[model samples]
Target chain A: MTIQPAFQCERLCIDLPGAPGVRRIIEDLDLEVGRGQFVSILGGSGTGKTTLLRALAGLTSHSSGRAVYEGREVRSPVPGMAMVFQDYAHALLMWRTVRRNVALGVEGRLRNGELDQKVQNAIRMVGLERFRDEYPWRLSGGMQQRVQIARALAMEPSALLMDEPFGALDAMTKASLQDQLLAVQAETGATVLFVTHDIEEAIYLSNTIILLKGSPAHIARRITVDLPRPRDQIVTKELPEYLRLRHQLFEAFRHEIHA
Target chain B: MMTAVNAPAPAVAGGKERPWIFHAADNVWSALQGLLPLIALLLLWQMLGDSRSPYFPPPSTWAAALIDRTNSGDLIPAVLVTLQSVAAALILATSLGVGIGGLIGASPALARCLGPTLEFLRTLPPPTIVPVAALIIGVNETMKLFVIVFAALWPVLLNTTLGVRSLHPTLLEAARSLQLGVVARMTKIFLPALLPSILTGVRVAAPLAIIVSLLAEMLTLMPGLGALLLMAQRNFNAAEVFGLLTVVGSFGFILNAALAAFESWALMPQGRT
Candidate 1:
């Protein structure tokens, strides 16, 4: 059986205006993400990874081509799509309570009672029920990131786009959040397109990985993970298959650099 | 499950005291701190004045005159007039300054184009325009209001613009994503974000407002505390001059304290730091 693409970027190009003229950031980029699939886009710094995410989120305009959601061309962010920004501090509104921040996404869409229920559920899902009434600034970094996740989940988007959500975290926090994200994705059955530079994180959390190379990014390689659900980090990292896949990805990345 | 990090042992001498009381104590302490210099100046003035000199009245003579004026309602009307000018000018300045500042802050091109001109306007000494304002308005209440507005507007306007411009982009993005309507966005995001800076500006401008209003009154001779001081100066009644000075000082303290109180309540509903 052939899987249909949930998100498709066709010949998308981005132009960033400069002093002289408009400079091209990304060109002739095409990508696909399948439904309910956890896809990781791995790229080095300045490879237009963030610009691509911004275009997908409809925050940045593309100079040419289309980003299609399901089969429809996406001109702007629709209700079925939500994004998690890289900066946890910037992700949630500091002036608002955790519940209010989470409820912010679905404002005007749901009634007060329904919104409260949804917010509660999302907070509970992220294990932030106790901190629902606290402001974002008062919480620890990991807790704040969880609140960001809760906010995205509360939006109830069919697809969640994360831009290096755990990059700012320490190793332990990053590992924990990775597990939490995997669990959230599994429970909600929401398709996720997460961008990361960490190869191990991509391998452990993603079902499919697409590696983008250089400026005006092109797909350098793609890998598929056949790992079972509820994968243990320690056990999985020790597995020969995981090590072999890691080595293969490392080689591909090095080859792209040399090329 | 990190008990040490999440939940620490309570270290307390006492607990369950009213948090509001501590806030009140803090306010009182700061108020006393502000008043200390004024009190020292008053003591020095008293020491410099000999009891025999008519030109330099002693503190006791000034105190007696202040009490006499208060009892006889001699300075009441003058105080009221000064208060009226301050109220009018403050209302006009805040409304105009905040509105104009917000407009300028929101538009980068406009701010850049107009910044130098605005800076030049601010640099023009407010008192220099008093003569022009007096001539235009014919030594009426309008002249006083204009001078007060002229003096007070710049600080509020500049601070408000800085506040608005410095607003965090993430907060704006959050507001946009939340679909907060225009009015809601302004009130919740812009207004609240601009408030602390606005308060600082207003506090700085409050004394200037009083000073300008008093000066305008003195020039116009329109029955204000400043005019009363001018009358005392002309008659060489040092006691009355010192008395009125005391009243002005008290009024300044009251207005500043009132602003501080309002700021405390408005900006921080959950215990000010």
Candidate 2:
């Protein structure tokens, strides 16, 4: 029998307390994410992209319908799933060293030696082994973001929910981190639901890009990226298919904005 | 390897290491500069004052009186008693403040409910309650401790509450997502984040702890430096009074310096450069 999808959101709706009564954020949204698949949710500003991600992570409750994780209703954060937030500085414990921060998720669950190895592997995956003893606050923004990712990775979750994790970094750092994230996913085979507004970044990193449109948003299009694996930043962008997909997304975004 | 280390490296002397004695000398020089005016006034008073003056006794007279106290059996024990009360009160205040502060800070409804009564209690001067406390609790070590804790707890509680309120929302989310249990949340997350602020509160409260304990001792006449100082004044022993004042001032100075050193070390970021 085929395994169930990692997450399924069925007719999910969410509302937020606004200045003018309660405002609807997500309406009648349905989505299914397969295990080990890389998907990026792309949207414009104020389109409830984050609200959807939060609902899936079980951080924010839905007004109606359901968000299902591994065939169970998700009303709160569940085991075997971890979230990497955008604000690395705030997300990380500032007082903890890189090694300790990475260990935060899985520290008490495993034995001391097992926990140490998991933390070490995660640090090595993010290339933060050299600065293991240094506190998170002392690291640069890119390094700090890596510390957060490593923290999530150490949990060894079946699925990773990331919300604009690399949005705060400069171009060089963002590109490098994207490649590192792809490699990490390949190794762990964890399903990823990444949320971002950057068109090029979504196309580069995801196997499928879900373009979100309109207020109280639902997915407007889900485009599968059939590009070759072991993707190179320079070579992949130069590919005609990659260029076509990039153009297609830009056009979609432009058309949606005008509408 | 394109490992770009963007963080600023910590400052080091770069060449041969300077001897620690030189650093010590620099600190001593600065401290001496700070004390110069007081030293000058004391020296002038010692040179100009009459030996048998009823008032305005010189530093020499104060020193003689201090030596006399040392020879007597009462001085050391009184100081020890005062120190004990201050230490106990401070310990109690810190624990109670952090415990209650964390709860109130985490819950908006709790803070709102307790805010009025706490504000009212906070406003009533601690010393003003001492007599009232003595009447109710009776003048003993327990009453003394209660008075000092009441006086010292406000700073720590206020600081810890402020610390908790300012905590990053994402940190709690991170903790929750990690499936960290309640005990782990407090020990690992809350305590570490609130530490610097707690230390700040304790620093402010330390002086209050010492002062209030002394006040309680004086009011009760329960055998401490406070009582000794009052007794000396009542007997018109000007020299003894001056000596005791100097002793208290020295204790305050040393306590403050020790706390500052501890706070600096505790807050020092590890593995810089």
Candidate 3:
């Protein structure tokens, strides 16, 4: 079945101020994301994977090109778009309780009872109903990232942007969060553009993987995941298809490292 | 690395039957260690004043005078006056310092441009300005508050600027991605992020507040603890001077403790623990 483009980026470029002069971060990038699809952007450090996601969220100002979302030009982050950052400890405000953090995603922008209901539902969805009153610092790394995901989900955004959301967790925690994130994305059916440096993670979670280059990041490659949904952490990792995809992505990363 | 030393000292309770006696010994040992410097100072005073100098009084004589002052209430009023000056200075300095600090901190370009000039102003000996302040504002409460605010504000201001600038990048990105407006971002993210640093700066500035308040009063001959100390000096009341000095030191200690308690309590609600 054909799907409409949830977002389209045309020749997007980013120039950042530097010590000597302005540095070009990204130049002339084009991409498209379909509704309910999970897209991953993979890049080495200094490549503009995160920057590209930020541009999509309207948090970064591009020197050129356009990010069209649902036939509208993206200029600022609105209800239709939401972002989850790396370093979950800082992503959620230390001062806000878990419930309040989720509430913050929807409150004042939505009707009163509806906002409350959404917050509750998101909390339950994240399996953090028991910790609704606890602060972000009290949560484990994986749990805190879950709260961040829940906050994004609570907004009911059309497209979700996640930048290495589980990057700070231990390996075990990272695997667990990967499953939980895929589950959430499946349940919500929100289009996702997630960025990461881990090649295996990119393949395991993404429906479409976009590779980025450094020193004025440009699209290096694109790979599609044809794996079945409702994926399991243990079974999925052991599968032959998963192993093949992992080897392919790792080879690509190895090339970048060699370069 | 520290485990070798920290490993259950026999003196710790619940370790052994002898722990009660050892715990008492430990308390006494630490208390004696804290008092070692005071004991040394007293010994030096006694040695110096062994019928040779009028400038230095023995610790026993200072203690006697301090006890007498407690009975007489004269020292009490003088101490109270000094404390009041410190309080007033602290209030004025905090409000003005934090206000100006927040303004400068919010504007990084302005802070960078004016920081050196502010540093120069802060480095000037605060006492030197007392006479100028006296001439302009006269030797009044206003002069004392002015000097206190002027002299003590730098640490707070600089700290605040540093605090605001020290915001975690993830928090900032979160705020922006959440679609918070500029004013909402400032109130929610900037203020909260800067609070710890602001408290640290205020802690650093507390002693400055006391020093400037007393310095201003002494230079301008205002009726505060500094003037009281000066009066004691002129009368050659060595014991009274020592007594007043002790009071001033204690007051500074108490004020700092209070501020520390407040800092801990305020930050506690934010899950700082």
True contacts kept of each: 0.16, 0.60, 0.79
DockQ of each: 0.38, 0.61, 0.63
lDDT per residue for candidate 3 within B39-149, as digits (tens), equals 788788777664323566666777787788778766777677778877777776777777778878778788888888988988888888888988998888888888887
Q: Model 3, residue B71: what's the lDDT?
A: 87
- The 10-residue segment with the lowest total lDDT in model 1 chain A: A70-79
Question: How is the predicted docking of candidate 3 categorized under the CAPRI scheme?
Answer: medium
> Model 1: which residue pairs collide?
none
> Over all chains combined, what TM-score does candidate 1 have?
0.88
RMSD of 2: 4.2
Write model 1 residue lDDT over A172-238, tens digit each, in one string. Answer: 9888888888889989999999999888999999899988886667777778987777888899888
* C-alpha DockQ for predicted model 2: 0.61
Clashing pairs in 2: none
Q: Each model's C-alpha lDDT?
A: 0.82, 0.88, 0.80
Give the clash count for each candidate.
0, 0, 0
lDDT of 3 by residue, A1-259 (tens): 7899998989988888889999999999999999998999999998988888888888878899998888888887756888988888877878888998888756767888888899999998889998888778777888888899899889888788888888888999898788888888878899999999988888889899998975899998888888877788778878898999998878877867787
Among these predicted structures, which one has the highest TM-score?
2
Q: How good is model 3 by TM-score?
A: 0.83
TM-score of chain B of 3: 0.77
